[model samples]
Each structure stands twice: as C-alpha cells, then as structure tokens.
Target: MTSRDTVTDPLPSGRGAALPDGGGVPASPPIPPRLLTDLIDSAVRDHGERRAIDFLGRRWTYAEIGALVDRAAAGLQAMGVGPDVRFGLCLPNTPYFVILYFAALRCGATIVNFNPLYVEHELRHQIRDSGTTVMAVIDVASIHAKVAAVAEESGLEKIIVCPLADILPTFTSLLYRLFKRSEIARWPADARHMAFGDLTRANPASFKPVAVTPDDVAVLQYTGGTTGVPKGAMLTHANLTANSHQMTLHVGHGAEANDRIMGVLPMFHVFALTTVLNFSVDTAAEMILLPRFELKQFLKTVKRTRPTKLLAVPTMLTALNKAAASQDVHFDDLDFVVSGGAPLPFDVRQEFERVTGARVVEGYGLSETSPILTCNPITGVVKDNSAGPPFPGTTLEIRSLDDPHRIMPQGERGEVCARGPQVMKGYWNKPEETEKVFVDGAIRTGDVGYLDEDGYLFLVDRIKDVIICGGYNVYPRVIEEALYEHPAILEAVVIGVKDDYRGQAPKAFVVLRPGQSASTAEIAEFLKTRLSKIELPREIEIRQSLPKTLIGKLSKKELVAEEAKKAAG
Candidate 1:
C-alpha cells in the first residue's frame, strides 16, 4: 500500500545525448503504477486536521472532505456508477468538483472533465465521443441549460445538479439564493435529475470499495490535437499520480500545512487540475478557490488568506505585474509562482519578480503529458526564454519535424518528443490518430523546440495553429470553420495575433463571395452562438481575396507575417 511500490516496463531513456550534470534531468528508478485516489487518501491520513479547501467564505478540512467523498461515492454506486461508467463533471471551481472528482474515481468510474463555458454544440460532440452517461453540472441557468439540451439527444442519460449556494456560508447562501435566484435553472423531478444533497447523503457503511488499478483510465482530458480537433487523452491512474509525484519533487518539500495555493485557473483544465487540485491534496496545502479570476477580488483574497504559492499562466503574471505598480496589493506572502499552460514572457517574469519579490519560474507541457514535464528550478538558476529542465522520470528529445523517427542533435529546432510515466496511454477510441503521435516510444509534442546543452527546453514555434488566449488553448481551425458557416464568406483563414492582455488571440481574415458582402460586426454576431467567447476571433477582416498556396489551399503564413509587421509598427 506504500506510494513507491515498484512498476514494470519502465519508460525508456529518450535523451539522445547526455549534457552537463546529466542534462539537468535527474535520474530515478522505475515509476510505480500508482492510483490517483491513493494520493488523497494519504493526504487525509497525514493532514486530516489541516484545512483542505476554501471557497468564498466556506472551508473544509481534509477529514471532513474525506467523509463527504465516502458518502458521495456510495451514492454514486447506488446510481449505477461503477466500473466502466463514465462520469462527466461540467463545473466551475467549487467544493462539489473537488469531492465528486475523487468520489467518481473511487467508484471506479472514468472522469470526463468539461468546461463550464462550452456551448451546446461543443458539449454534444464530447458527450457522444467519450460515452459519458452520468454528468455533474452546476445549477446555474446557462450552464445547466446547455447540458440538459444535449442530454436528451446525446448519449448522456443522468444529470447531477450541484447548486452554487449549497457550499456557501449560511448567511451568504441565503443572500445568494434570495438575490441571485434567477441564475438557477429549473428541472423536473425525474429519473434524469438528482440533487447534490441527495448524492451526498448515502450511508457510509454501504460504500463498497471497488478494486481499482493503476493502469485503468482515470480521466479523459480533451485537448486540440494536430488536426485541430478536440480529442480526449486517456490518462491512466499511474499517469496522473506519477505526474503529481513529479510535480511535488519539482516544487520540493515544505513544512506541514505551510502553503496555501492560489487557484484561479479553471479546475477542468489539465494544468490546474494537476497543479492546483492534485498537488494541494498531495502536499496537504490549503487551496483557496476562486470561481473565476477578477483582479480586485484576487488581490482582496490574497490580502485575506496570505497564500504562499500561486499557480498562474502568463496573462495572469502580466496582469499582476501591472497591478503591483499602482494597486495596494502586497505579494510579500507569495513564496513563488509557477507559470504554465502558456509560454511565460521573459520581461513579464523579470518585472513581476522585481516588483513582488517572488521568484516566478516558467514550465511547459501539454494535456497529453499529464500537463507538466519541464519547470525551472524554484530557487536555482532560471534561464530566460527556457522552460527549464525535464522533471525526474521524464525523457525529452528533439526529433526532426520531417521524420518523426529521427532524433535531432542538441540545440537543433525540431518537434519536441517526451516519454515518461506521466504520459497518457493514447487518445480514447482513436487508435489510428494515436499511432501517428508516437515515434520510438515517445509522444510527439508537435512543437518546434530544442534542448540546450543543460537540457532546458526552448519552444520556438508551434506546428499547430492553436492560439493560447488567457491561458486557454483556442483552435484557429475551430474559429475558421465557424466563419465559413456565414453565407457571404468564400475563403477563411485564422491566425494568432499578439495582444497586450491575452498573450495571443485568434484573428480571422475572410474573402467575401462574388457580389456578396458581410460586415465584421455581422460576422462576429453570427459567431456568438457557435463559438465560446475565448474561441471567438478578436478581429474579422473582410478582404477581396485571401492568400492561398499554389494549389489554391487557404494559407496562414502570409497573414501571420503581416500581423507581425503591424505589431512591430
């Protein structure tokens, strides 16, 4: 039952050539097939008395949360959620997500995370693709409506509605229900709907522990693949737990109940799911949850909680860097900040650290790699424009872009490939697509980057046109496809444009059909229903003709260069 039990068929050493200090990648023994639930169990046993989560004015300790998970797991089992069951959680940051995530896994059900901002169209594709039968959603009107609309037509059968005011402080709950009652969605008392209170009231004695293993799929995190379509990465229990181990090792150890992690990123996102949620449970740190990040509220919470750690993306650092100069925010309590999910700019890091006195380090990985592989040393040398070195138990190499089979020399720009226990098994139900991403037993990252002599990874360019807006991946193809739906559009091309606020945002260029015309505002209004706010293009430029390749295929390279020139001007 120990955490370090041995595992067989270890990940290979994909490191092509050794560098100084063994390429700054620490060596470790074989990675064990560890279960994700084991991590929370261990934290509960060790730090049961410590505070585990804080949302709004409410809080729960590890022991209290563990008991809730037990009862919830029993209720889920009674609802026919067990082995081979796929449970979807479409919720924002709340205690319900924290409890249900582990509870569903404890019931031997595969967890499928959904973004609360998804429109009905996006929800339908994922539900059908992943075969999610039972779903947990917040009772907010728009969010619940989207799921309910898809439930009847899609494979989804049951919906577990969690209320927002249920976990709020008693007085706050009354005020929320009284004033914000219109936000609540109404559903009938039928077989398809269940309340959170009912889900958590089952007798703990009836909870039969299912026999779970490490290799079983734990979570289905969807990310845009090489084709710009969202695909679920089948993360095994071993993959997730090992990544937690690797993250804990990278962050180093701290005193018991010492750190409070600031979690502003969406819990459904892979980076925050691993770093903010799992990492806190692994270290027994108190997690201060914010439903969404607002500059005023974030600083207010920081002042109140005095958190020691902050898990952030580049845009967040950019905002804080600007706020620290004028606002009365004090970041003295922040020990360090780990920036991931998007590339962290050099000046953003330098300015933030200079003003706040907190060491901000950049990290890199994809959802397919349990969301983390390389991070700069916390208190050690941090190179500019580098994603630091590979974590222990992970091997990263630069493979030639043209030939996935060939590994490139050191400092050569090529696609980044990685192999480790933290890597997912493959895409769910897509064997043909899965086969194309792995070469020589390593996951092809589809990013053009090189490793320095010290083994630090530098991402030069992305092979895919995925725009990272405010730390979330926004696919250009998704936006382009949406634009083509307009009758007036004959040709469409989308590219990532630099923005001062969001690191990058999608920008659309379209050519109107002969004798047909559509205004930018008109096209934008059309896209509101088809695309999420983040997926919407910031600018839609109508043109007589869009740049095309020799074969008349829509091209984006010329558009990208033009944007760069304008930005320079």
Candidate 2:
C-alpha cells in the first residue's frame, strides 16, 4: 500500500467551512477497519531497512523490531495473553515498550498504560481497577518494588520484567547490568516473574494475529479524574484508526514518509501514543525516542538526529526557548512542531519560532476523543492563540455550561463538545459516568472554549479548574496568562483554595527564571492593571519549580491537594 492508500477523504464539503486556501478541512475517508498493530506491519513492509527507532546510541531497523514484536507476541500467547485479556504496560519510552505494546495488541489484548513512577498505593488502585493480571514493567529498583507491592495486594499473576540492559548490545548490556546492578530490582527468584529476555526466547513467531473488529477495545487509557475515582476511557480500534486518519488530514502531507520524528514525550501519554508512536508507524517515519525529557540531552539528540517533526508539550517548548536564549541550539532542521498537553504561552511560542525557525502550532484533545480533536493546519493559516480547526470529520460545538443540550452561538465561551468517529466507546465499566459526559452523541469536553467564524477553536479553561471568588467565576488560565507576561516568571499555575468568606479563592504558584527574582506583592501589583480585583489571585507563592503531570502539563490538582493538606494541618 502507498502512503495515501491507508486513508482518504470521505466526507463532503458541506461538513465544514472552506479553508483560507478555498478548501474545506481535509475530510478523512472512511478509515478501513484495521487493528492498531497493522501500522507496524505496514511500516516494516514499506521501510523495513530504515531505522524504525533510535534509543540511546542503539538503532533498531523496522524489520528487526517487527521480528522482536512477533517473538514477543508468541511469547505472550504461550503465557495465555489472548483476546479480551487485559495486558498492562507499565514501562517507559524504551525499546521494550515499543515491542511489547504491539505484541500485546497483536494478541488481541487491551493495552492499559501505567505511569512507572506510581507508588504502591497508586499501582494497586489501577491494577485492581483495570483487572490487569499480566503486566510488563521496567526492571529498575524503585518501580519494581512498587509493582511487586501491587502484585502482592492484587491478583497479578504474571510480571514480565524488562531490564534497561536487556535490549542493549551484549557487551554494553553486561557493562550496564554490572554497573547498574544496585539500581536493578531482582524480583524474588520465582515462577510468577519472568525476564523479558527469557520470554522472547520462546520465539513463537508462528503465532497468528487474533481476528478483531473495529469496535474491539484496543486500549484502556486512564484519565486523571477530577470528580471521582480515576476511570479508564475505552478506546476502540476504530477510534484510534480514525484519529490517525484525522491527524494525517489535519497535517496534510507535512510529515513525509521516513521523516525523523522526535519522541521526547512519554509514549504512555495518549497525545504521544497517537502522535509519536502510532502516527509515525502509520506514516513509516523513523521515531527518535527519548526515555524522558532532559533539556541538555534532548538538544544533543536533536543535533545528531536532525528530526523533521517534534511532538512536544508546552513545558518542553518553554525550556527550549530558555536554552536557546542563552546560546545557540540548532533547531532549524525541524520542519514543524506540534505543542499539546497544555496551552502554549504566546511568549514561549514566539521565542521558539524566532530561535528555531520552526512553525509551532497548538492542538487540543482528550483521552476520550482518541486524544486529538483540533490542530492548526500544517500547510495553511494558523490563527494566534487558537488550537486551530476541528479535525476533518469532527464536529465541535460550544454549548451552555448550565445546560449542555443548549448549543451556544459562535465565538461564545462555553463547554466544548465534540462528536466524531474518533470518540471513544465510553468510560470502561462506568455506564453512569459515561452517560453524564455524552449528551446525545457528543462528548462534553469539560473544557471551556469558543469557536471562531472560520472554525478555529480557542480554549479558555477547564470548568473544574475555574475558581469561584465571592460568587464570581474566575478562570485561573486568565490569571496564569497574565503572570506569564511577567518577564521574571518562568512557570505559573493558579488553583482554587478554601476561603473563610468567599468559600474559595485563587492562589498562584510561580517559578522564576534563573537569576531572576520577584516578590509576590510586585506580581500582584503588575497584574492589578491587567485583571479585575476579583479575578486576580489573592495569594502568590514563589517556588523553585511547580508540579507537573506525567505528560508535563501543570498539575493544578497537586497544588490544590497541597493546599488542602496545609488547611487540614
């Protein structure tokens, strides 16, 4: 199959307005009902000799990765991981993660992503919640201990330990294992635990792919629940496949086949999973993986690889801008950069583009909508501060917060709702909660945003993140944006805290730029002219750094929890 053969334009022009180029949003043709694993198979067939992944100094060709995937799939089958079985993947962005992820899907098992940093308590909740019996985890000491604890608490039957050195060359693996022996977790010599190397040695390459339909569950992506217990969003094969097509349509051939795409963000994130892993595989692009984001190391890799596309978060961009301000960091080779996970500050975007000469555009998505709903067109006009237009087949409407059924007028701030082929089936095992979010056919994205006349979408803030000060709704994002305008402020997050009179009030946590200093009163004084009294943060706390989610979005939840704990104390 050719590059264009995997997807096509199926919708008519009437679905949306025309673009600046006198064309409607590129419509994705009916995505063929195919398993997510098919992307890897196609990549191997088309670019087998090309390097599929680059990790550390090691490079794995598409053909080599495909063989490993087959071996891992067969090994999983021998271990009883078949269709309908929940296979949990708790590894980070490593070669093991790539191989096992596809291998598990090839076995028709639902992939459940877990943050490797989670403690025992957190692991138990997710393990029990997803009913994952078999899990693949990194063989580091800290993570392994937590997984073992979860296994002891839950009915975790099999644990496949993927060592950091397992995938390295023989000499390097031996050196790494010897030097890093203290960091490696040796799970008690037992039958319940198996090394990834031993598992692959089974080499069941003859195992056949399981037959599955479009509706079959592909992954159970868990969301950071604000209202109640964390629930998994059930994304089907159809949902992910359509999103791959939608993104391709939105970007419009900017991502060429065999282009080097940077994978700095964790693949476990839905945003990175779609954009970095699945999308690159579908397009037969070479993916350069960074186990985690380290500004210095990332720049070094970029200089070496000369990646064409970067799928990054706002925080990474902010860091890059700061680094570039001090000295030259080559980024001119980057064809395009898509920033998601959080809102990209206007200043950061400007500086990044000025230094790197790469077009930086923002996109919006949630785990439930198979992640991507809107992205500024790569080949077309990008409006300032807008997340751009809806993906080809997606229909986005701004609805009244009071009544989700009441659709608001264009350019109105309200709850952003979306309906499309990419939307998930529902929240896993939570029919009632799913009913609450899905009104009619649209998924009520708890976010507050407006759509322009030309169909570009601009986000304001999340409804849950809104601060109520003296009976008035205050959006923290508005205050945060003002704080970002301050030259000294490097990172800022606003959260609602308990108040004696107002019931709740907004408080800002800020991180200053290196060698920069600012007093809380000075910040408040600066913002006084920019914001109304009630909208301004009542309290500002200066810190060395602010908390971040696994994907690096500012974690207002952690700040809120910290405030709550302080109040309790």
Candidate 3:
C-alpha cells in the first residue's frame, strides 16, 4: 500500500489467523463483496420477515424496512438527488435515520451526518462547508428553526422533515402524538418543509439503480475540530464496506441473521454509525434503537428486548454497573459487549462483566478509519490494559513522537499508526492536513500506545494529552486506572494544571460511587503504590459527575477547559 494508490488492497488469505497471545480461532471466513448498498438487499433476501428495527415498542421487519428504504430512495431521486450530491442527515437514533441512511446510499448520494443538537451557527457552518444540497432534519421546533434560518445562506436546495414517531404503529403513534406532542419538536410550515411520510407514501416503488463504484465517496464524516475548524473525512464506498467486513471478520463470529443488537448510542456518532447500524445491516441482525440514553427506559427496554449483543462506551458501562447495584437490571441474556470511543478502565471492565455475566472487550478506532482498527477478540483471551490486536488485514506500527517518519520497535511507547482498507481517502478538501496525518499509506492515530512481544497493544495516552510535570511525562490513564481500583471511586480523569514550580502538574477529578466517600488524601495514599511520585496529582477535586463527550466518553478536554475558566475567575 502507498499514498499514491487510491484504493486499498484486498486482504490476503491466512490474514485472519488467531493472534499468538490469545491463540487465533481460525482464518477469517471469505470476505463478502465490497458494496455498502448490497448489505440492505442481502439482509432482506436472507431474512425478510425478521425484525429489523425495534423502537419504543414499535417493530418493523426487514421486509418492511427494505420497502420503506426503496420508496424513500425513489422519492429522493425524484427530488433531484442523484450521484455525488451531498445529502445532510440530522436526526437521532430512530427508524427514520436507518431508512434515510440506506436510502441515500441506494441513491448514490454522499451522506453527511449532522448532530441534531447543533445550534444555528454550527449547523450553518457545516452546511456551508460541506456544500449540502438536500438536508434531512428532525421535526423539532428548535432544530427546524435553526435549519430553516440557515437554509438559504447555506445554499440548501431542499429540506425534508422526519418525525420522531413516523414509523411507529398507528396506536403507538397516536399515543405519542397525544402525550409527547408538546415535548416533540414542532415542524415548520414553510413550503420547502416536507414530511418524511410524504416522501415514502408518494413513491412506493423502487427507482433505477445508479452505477456507483467502490471509489465513489460514500460519506463526508466530520472530525471534532478540536485543533481548528472541523474538516470532513472523505470515506469512500470501499473504505466503509471494507471496514465493515473487517469488523465482521473479528466480531461477527456466531452472530446469526436472527440476533438482536442494541442501538443506544446516537447514530450520528461514527462509532455507532459504522459498528452498530452498518454492522447490523451487514449481519442481517435486528437493531433495538433508542433515541437517547435514559436510565429507567434503557433498563426496561433491555428486559423487554433481551438484546443478544451490545456495542457500548466506557461511561455507559459504568452507568449500567451503577444501576445494577440498586436496580434489578437484567443483562444475563446479553452474549458479549464491545466498548470503544475511549480507553476502557480495567476496574470498569471487570465490574461490568461481573454484573452482566458477559465478556466486556474494548476496541480502538477513529472516525477517519471508518471507525474500527483494533479490538479484543470475542472468542480469545482479553489481555488486561490492552486494546487487543489489530483487526484482520490491518497493519499497525508505533512511530517515534519526535520523528513520525521513524518507526519504533515493539515495547517502546510512541504514536500509534495504522494502515488498512478502512483508512479514509483523506480529510475532505484539506490536502495539507491529510498529508500531515497520512504518510506511506498509514494513518497516524494521535493516540500513544505500544505493542507487547505477543503483538497485544497497550495504550499510554494521547500524544497531545501527555502531561509533562517537572520534565517527566505523566500519562493520565495510569492514574485514572489506579483511581478506579478504589471501591469508592466510580469515575476519574486527570489533567495537567499550571504550577508555580513544576511548570505544569496533574490535577485529579473524582466522581465517588453511590453511598461511598473518600477524601483526596485517601485517594493519593492509595495511588502511592501504583503510580510514581511525579505522576501523582497535585490536587484532587470531588464532584457529582465529570463531563462527557456527545457519545458519553469521559472527556478530559471539557474538564481542562472548566479548570481553566475557574482559574481565570
């Protein structure tokens, strides 16, 4: 593989063998063809009548979902949406999202995901930057106003409104309209505002299929833009389809077409977009969709649905574990759990597994890689403090921080680099930024980690996140892991704070477990044996809860900003 090659090479045979430390299961099964739209048609052909989406007690079979997708695709095509036209999707995890996602792909249009919670300015900037043509927004009052206000300025040609209860059964829809109507966002009355129902009901037949190839851009996934203005990561059809195949090869073992997977994370996030939604469509498994995470509602849904598998994050797992202590939550039916989007603490992993009686394995990835790069094998041994091995057909290396061009030997901590069929074509329209991150056909994951002799990877911290206290590198994760070991600590994060002598020192934020308490001195004393002297936090702050990212991962960035504001005040 090289930077000059536009398409990633296909995986070779014997590439899926079990890793040495955990003993490989078997060579990866033959990979299916690389086409994103094919997943929908194949699932319908194989298991047409099986449940495809279970939302708020409303269920839609695969046959029904496929029919809706075809109708939506036909309707989108009729509305002048064609190949390469940028389509904006701004909705939560509902049946509307699933239908519109596959429908856009089926129509050969590039899908651009938007966080439904974005304000007017944020939405305007993304729409103007991505050059979106048709925007699909949720029928909420605030969201509709924001989109409508910026439509002309952003050069949006058309707008579609999807109701939260569009796909619900008639009775359920009536109930939602009656009781939840006030809470639901109201739709706009503009001539340009058309309902999702109108789109599907008006066109009940399939449209002509366009000639889309693997090289065509499928998605314009935007980065968080922590460094600067957000840039869209251009993921081609081959990149998404190949990454989906690689994920299935690693985690799809024994997942039958009839199995059910929980879709709790918002679909707008790339982690859920690829792993949960795309993976379920690839495996023909039913997805239990929850628009948002509510503690009581999540527990009830789990009891009623008994999903076979769940794709989760560390914060979600910690919340579930906390809920299990006081509430009678049922997780015994779950086969396994896959956690990603952030590092999974060893204590959180152990507590979650013990309560649910299921293996909780952590995976690592970024949005630019179509989201999956490495994962702990479900059927193999899960190494402690490691994110397991690289996915089958994926290549990983640790490079020096000072000189990224130089690859470091195993066991040496450095920047984690990955090259695979999953890496994005490049950052959309940012050639210089893309060139900086991608070299020799590999994507530099800003994360810092090292590989053991047996090829298992152990994460240290992000390159930008490493705190230099008194000239000694202090990795926050090591301290956070030690905090989790304490019975009273439920969640923790460490960030560097300015100091008079040490230049910058570590500050700990602790969230105590329910009904338990621990002082800052007690926490520091407990970590004395685990972390070196310089790695210890200079100050500890106790709070009810720490801030989290949109996907619920503990966000050190938010904590750092909050601390900075407090210092200024």
Candidate 4:
C-alpha cells in the first residue's frame, strides 16, 4: 500500500466521519482521519523549533527530531529495510526509540517492539517468531550477549546499538556510563553492532517516504499466546492512527497541545505507545522521558519537569503516592493520571488523589485494539470504578462467553467486545488464533466487564490468566515457565493475588523436587535478572502439590479459587 492510500483529506465536522477507502474516498467510512506519518509531518512543519522530547538532561526539537528520523529511515533503507520488512526495536523510552519508531514507519516497515527486560531465550524467541531482519537495541552488555546469541540464528543481518547517553556531550556520556554501569550493562557492546549515532550522522538527512496504505501493518505488538508461545498482533497504520484520534477526542479539553506529558511508561507496551508517544506527537507536546521507573528518579523528574499530564498504571501511581507522602513532593501541576493495563482498585484511586491532588482516570483496551477503546471522558462525571465510556465512533457490547454472537444486556457482566477502526488487522501468521478472536467485525477483548445505565464500563475479571503489574501485562504461563527453570522447582503455578496497591500481584505456588530445597527469596532473586519487576511474583508459596483439573492438567483457576476462599475465611 502506498502513502496515497493512507493519507485522506480531513473529514467534515460531524459526530463521526467516514474513513477513506483503500485507494479513494469510500461512501461512508469510520471517522475520516490522516495517517500517523502525516500527523508527524505537520508537527515538524508547524512546531519545528518546539521541544519534542526531553531525555535525561537533553532536549530535542521537532526539526531536529524529524531530521534524525529521516536519517534513520535512510540508514534503514541502506540496510535493506523497506516495505513489509519487520524491524525489531528494543530500546527504552528515549529519543532514539522515538526516532527509530517513526523512521521505520516512514520506510513502511513493520516495527516489532521487544521488551528490553527479556532474557536471552525470550529475546531469541521473539526475534525468530517475528522474522525480524534488523534490530535496533540499547548499547548495554547484557543486550549484546542476547543479541549475539540469536543474531545469526534468527536471520538478523544488522544490529544497531544506541548509547544511553549518546545525545549528551562527551563528558556527560563518560559520567553517565561510569555512574550507571549496573543498569546500563544490558546494552550491547560497541563492536557487535553499528552505533546509532554514527550511522545517523553519516547518512544524509533525506529519504523518500514509502507509499503506505492505512491497512499496511505498522507495528506487530506481541502478546503471550495460549499455546505457550508469543504471537504478534498486526496493528495497521489505520488501527494506530484511528485510536490516537479517538483518544484525543475522548480526552476532550483536559489536555492541550501546549501541555507537557510525562512519559514514564515503556514505549514497548501498547498503552504508552498510543497515549504517551503517539498522542504527544500528534498534539505537538513535549514528552519527558524516563528510561525506567525508579521512585526517586521518577519523583525528581516530575518535580523538575512539572508536567501537566501523566499516564501510568495503578502500581506506578501507588508507588508515586507513597514516595510523595514521604518526600513531600508537589504534584499540583498534574492535570490527570490516566491508568490502564490493569484494573484500578477503588481504594488505590482514592488514596492516590488524596495524596497527589490529582484525579485518576482509568481506561481499558488490549494490544490488538491499538490499545485504546474506552476511557474516562475528561469533562464527564466519573463513576467510582468504571473505565468511563466508550471513545467516539467506537461500539462496545458484552456477550456471553459461550455464545459470542449474543450480546448481553447492560448491567450483566460478560466478555467485552469492541468494534472500531482502531481494532487490529489480525495476528501475524496465526490465522486460527486471529479467527477465534475476530468474530463478525468486532475484536473479542478476553476481558469480562459490563456497562451501566450511564454507559460506564466496570471490569469484573479477566477471562485469561494474564497478570498486570505496574501497567505491564504479565502472563502466568511466562512466569510459571521461568519458575520451572530452577532445578529445585519440580512444579509451579502462578496466579494474580489482590494487592493494596498494584491491583493484582503475581504469587507463585511451587512444588520442590524430591529432596531439593530453595527459599522464596532465593527464587525471587534468581528471576530478577530474567524478568522485569512487574513480572516478578510478590510472594512464593511452597506447596506439597497444586490442585489440578479433572483431566489432571495444572489448573490456575482452581488455585485462584482456593486462594480466594482462603482469603475470605
């Protein structure tokens, strides 16, 4: 598909405008909109000198950012990255990440965003599964080891290593490397891959934008599979662009183009991708980047940046509130705290507002929906625990799990399904899995929720065993597989347990091998480097045996039920 296919004239002012067809204007399309690339181009042309991203201590203007993105696109073209090529981006929330992301899109390549915390095995699996030919990674030692392990095996021909402080001056780079060695050790080595800086500096700051259609796959966000493997959700340009516009409209007058946004969430996650990165770019707002969320650093950044908008999960909000209470940090500048990636407990929301003086607005979506389906209206009266109302032009219906075709009436909880342009095209190369979720024309959100008389959504439970901690989705199967890696662990089952802060935290029930022994702390420490903090279990329970289904398969549902009963008693 060509750029001509994606770019359409703005629609007339109306409730919902029709989207253009694949090549020309359609009779009636869902919300007519510009492509994501067009939005960036306009930002660059209008806000060329405006601050686009602030990282560490350096700031990048829109002109500088656009030039860098173009150079990166040129470099990728030089490396044979073009239409349909899947390029892996493994950097954190930094200017390099934004550059590479838009650059790949500009080249019409599908971006495969990889979690930087993935172990070598997980990284290898994603690289192989996505069939990525090029990977742009942070320049850290651990990442180097993982990339080296799978570079040749996965058919990855090129690796681009970006320094954590490359945009900073020479002295700052030296100090950053010396002071941040422990955390930065995960970056790849200098010799293993081309440096992002050198490549961009050498390349010309001009490249032809590839013709892309709205239906062209822009990003392939991978999610944990029910079959014990991960698959990429094919989110097309139309999917992402439409979702961003939907969110922008839903936010209403709360956020303006001049408002600065705190981007503490990882760009790899779809929540941050749409709300923080894409939304900020579309509005021509400055994004204050935090590579990772550390309480002290996070507080310091917020204090320094004084951002007007904040997007985060319940766990991050809980931690920030605790830190604010102790440190006396001022959050009067924050306009709204947008929460997602998990359910927001009522108490947590209340406490956060009491402590920070900011209202928390909860939203809901999955990776397959370009991540934003329902959100709290910026000006509406909010229900205590609802995820607000559906965004403009989006339709939500809860259907019985057994009969997906039958939509349940309001106030009755069932599987939440959504229909909109933001819905993904399909799962990459997984036709059966794609068919199972995409029924009729709507996407089945595997989450169970219901709508009230006021059209507000209240989430009851997740149909899938996915644990969300600190706004990141943590699959129980992934954690259980990690537990099995320990020689002492004979069998293990992981489940999400209620937490005062994080909504739900992972808890592992383990059975030791005959005569083998290991403590909870030991297992926790063992998995620390292998998984991100959100994926780690809060507690580990040594079990003589785990309850199983009638077929004898280890059942997490039974374990959750027993835990619930124990807690009630």
Give the best candidate by TM-score: 1
Superposed model 4: Cα runs more than 4 Å off: 1-30, 169-171, 178-192, 202-206, 225-228, 253-256, 485-488, 513-533, 565-569
lDDT per residue for candidate 1 within 246-340, as digits (tens), equals: 87777778435468999889999999999888889888889999999899989998888888999999888888888988876777788899999
TM-score of each: 0.96, 0.79, 0.78, 0.89
| lDDT tens digits by residue: candidate 3, 522-554 | 998987756556677999899999999899998
Off by more than 4 A, model 1: 1-8, 11-26, 254-257
Q: Select the stronger candidate by TM-score from 2 and 3.
A: 2
Q: Give the TM-score (vs. native) of candidate 1.
A: 0.96
Estimate the Cα RMSD of every predicted model relative to the unseen true structure: 2.7, 11.1, 11.4, 4.9
Candidate no. 4 TM-score:
0.89
Which candidate ranks first by lDDT, i.e. highest? 1
Range of the 10 consecutive residues with the lowest summed lDDT in candidate 3: 11-20
Ranking by TM-score: 1, 4, 2, 3
lDDT of 2 by residue, 175-263 (tens): 98889889988887797899998888875656876887766889999874335356899988877877887777666762355588899
List pairs with backbone clashes in candidate 1: none
Between candidates 1 and 4, which one is better according to TM-score?
1
Model 1 alpha-carbon miss at residue 365, Å: 0.2
